[model samples]
Target: MTTIEKALIRLHEVDAQSRGDFLLQTLDARAKVIVTIAYIAVVLSFSLTSFSGILLFAVFPIVSASMSGISYGQVFLRSMIALPFIAFVGIFNPIFEREPMLVAGDLTISRGWVEFLSIMLRGVLTVQAALLLIASTGFQRVCRALGCLGVPQIFTTQLMLIYRYIYVLINEAIRMDRARRSRSYGRRHYDLSMWATFVGQLLVRSVGRAERIHRAMLARGFDGHVRILGHLRWSSTDTAYCILWIGLFIAGRFFDLSSVLKFL
Candidate 1:
């Protein structure tokens, strides 16, 4: 099969796999949205100094990923892509504060190190939670949920449009790359010039495609907003899930389960 066909097939397979997951299908759009928001809030509220607390909190993503049937490897790949920015923000914490704040046996660790580690852990947990949410709920449900949560209409509409068009752009890029490889076979190694040319051509084509998409939208009477066809009604299952997680978060924070574990 052609590269374009292969890309399309892979995309469809992913969509199918996501659909086959029972836990993902159980939550309606609103429920998924609420769960995602609540999960993030709970993860963020933990104290940085509480190592055991963070470790206990970490169970949610692992369990969710398994239950949702999403590939942990795929989630890790996405997380790695975004880690640098997060690391950059947290790396400085360890540099500025060097005083020893805690003693574990004979080893002393700086307060800054604890803070930095916390920041890094927070970033990873937050990002992974988001990725899992999107992988399970799908992007359309997320956009709709955002809309329901009172995010500005314009922002949600743009998000929807960009997400919808991203596959088209990726397919176009793959097609262009294939064409280049076909013609360049048996030729000298590709240099910077060839690389720049390919990227520039892709950008130009993407812009043209965007223009055509805008015209298509206009023709369809799109009035600067996307209208989802269905309404999301929250069920009892969603409420239970939300309450359970929120309760665990509260318990974890106040009781310091991690410290208790170490004591035992």
Candidate 2:
């Protein structure tokens, strides 16, 4: 299968997983969303010199994956996609700032390298926290949770629409490409001219599809709000879930466990 086909399959698989009756999926969307936000906030609040303390935050995702019935391999693989961007932004740190921050016997480590690793840890933590949220809660309920959290309805509506639009757009692209491939005599790849034609056709088709979708929404009375079935309840477990994670996050932000370890 082609790259687009594989991507579509992965997308569908993730969607399927989100709807599963696992631990995290069973919780209130608002509670999960709030905990995710708080988790990310704490992850970002760590000092740049904090490597060991930040490492402790990995427990959050570990526990989440364990309870949520989502495989660690799957989450780890998905999380790696964002690493290239971090590498691009962070690759310069070691070169620009060469001053040594720490020394151990004959070995020395520069402050720049330390900062780069710190940034990478933060990126990974935040990304996993986000991926866990979407993978466990799905998109629609995430928006519902955001709405409950006092986010503007218009913003969440647009976010959901964009997600749905991109999904449809990918399907359109896959179909168009397949049609082109079927007509091609022996060509393995499209030429520049073919790409130009493909994009032009895609644009036109996308416009038409958008219009159709808009009309359908209007017919259904989509007035800047999306309502899904079932109500979100804040059970005692959800309250404890929030308190436990947030408490850990706050502890992470204030206390450096690495120092404690070294002291001991």
Candidate 3:
């Protein structure tokens, strides 16, 4: 696919994630943020050589995605985006540690592979959990949640501004891409020089547009504080939601499901 097409497709996928009608989507932002943080902490607490229990924790994402109306494909595709960076970080595990960690009959598993798989599994869990959060709660609520969770207002405001304007910047890029396509009949792709010029012009245009928007906001009484989040009380439903999931998380943290199932 073309670069412009890929950008538009990703934007569409993001839009889909933001518009679902699901239980997770209806929860208080602060509750969701707190629970997500707790879930992630539990997922990461497992030892590197340990397995199975962490895999059992996959239920969180699957159930969450189901509740959030997010398809497996959507979560998988979005989650895969982080694989490269995680791979880069964990790539040296197998090379550096080759001692045997587990053995079954003639089958011996090296600590390196075990640690490597553990890292990848942890990455997948965290990524899916985060994507589920964004998909269910959307970006605006996420900002509100962070502010309510005592994250710096400055950080939340900047994040909100960036997310709000990113669409405008992308639309500007689309216009430029269309303009380029119209002018270049034989070759749709621009040369490196053309790209450089396009980027410089895009930067200039973006700055001017942003300045105008900022002034307009200021003229309309744009206060520095985020007024998006009202006073949120922890409702009974929110309490129940946390209890059910965090209970499961705590249970999974201490027990390996596979081992338990072997007894049954």
TM-score of each: 0.78, 0.88, 0.89
Candidate 1 ranges with C-alpha deviation above 4 Å: 1-17, 71-78, 182-200, 207-225
Candidate 1 lDDT over 1-264, as tens digits, reads: 555567677556546655764776567767766766777887788776655577687777887777788777777666766668877887887798888988989999898888877777777777887777776777677778888889898998888887677678778877776777689875544589988988898889888987997899899997876777878778888888778877877787678787677766
* Residues 1-264 of candidate 3: C-alpha lDDT, one tens digit per residue: 467668767767766777777787778877788788999999999998776778888888888888888787678777888888888888798889999999999998889888888888889889998888887887878888788788899999999988878788888888888888778985866799999999999999998998998899899898876566366567899999999989988888876766887887
Residue pair clashes in candidate 1: none
Per residue, candidate 2 scores C-alpha lDDT tens digits across 4-121 of: 8888887787688789988898999998988988888888877787778888889899889877889877887788888899978987988997999989999999988998898888
- The Cα error of candidate 2 at residue 89, in Å, is 2.0
Clashes of 2: 0
How far out, in Å, is residue 241 in model 2? 0.7
Ranking by lDDT: 2, 3, 1
Model 1, residue 84: distance off in Å is: 3.1
Candidate 1 or 3, higher lDDT?
3
Look at candidate 2 and give me any clashing residue pairs: none
Candidate 3 lDDT at 262 equals 80
